[model samples]
Target: MSTLRIYISNQCPSCATAIHRVHFVRRLRPEQSVELINLDHQDTVRPSYVFGTPTYCLGNQIIFLGNPSEGELLSKLDQPLSSVKQIT
Candidate 1:
């Protein structure tokens, strides 16, 4: 199964909105998995190439840089594994 990785910071309103949207999606799709990474509390170093807070990563590919529309997220979730290549 694919995971949705959400990168966030405490002070970002957009992050809160993104999280809310993710939870909304989760309620609709219980099987979907989500991982929230709080930049403020990270113990390890963050990748330098990461775009910004409220980023959404599907597998190794980033689907959104900031807040994503519900439809956009759902569409990505609906994509089959055959269509999305797994990145190393």
Candidate 2:
């Protein structure tokens, strides 16, 4: 499955929003795989230090920050995997 990591804390509103949005997308597009990584958990935080409540990483490359957006997620569905980050 393609990696879609979401770093979030359960207590955060943004994280909750992101989770719901991700679930919506998952239901709509069953073909895609979405993984929710809880930032509060020690295991997840070590691999990815999420300063903010909600952060999205598409295959180890962060594509979005802050609150989640359905439109933004859909827009990048077709983008090729980048080398984590793009300087531009």
RMSD of each: 2.3, 2.9
Return the lDDT, model 2, position 75. Answer: 68
Q: Which ten residues in a row have the lowest lDDT in candidate 2?
A: 79-88
Q: Ten consecutive residues with minimal summed lDDT in candidate 1?
A: 42-51
- Model 2 residue 24 CA deviation (Å) reads 1.4
lDDT for model 1: 0.78
Q: Give the runs in model 2 whose Cα sits over 4 Å from its true position.
A: 83-88
Number of the top-ranking candidate, with lDDT as the measure? 1
Alpha-carbon TM-score of each model against the true structure: 0.82, 0.77
Question: Could you give candidate 1's per-residue lDDT for residues 3-85 as a string of tens digits?
Answer: 88888888988888887977887898889888888888959456565657887878766777898789888888888755764
Index of the highest-TM-score prediction: 1
**CA displacement after TM-score superposition, residue 50 of candidate 1 (Å):** 1.5
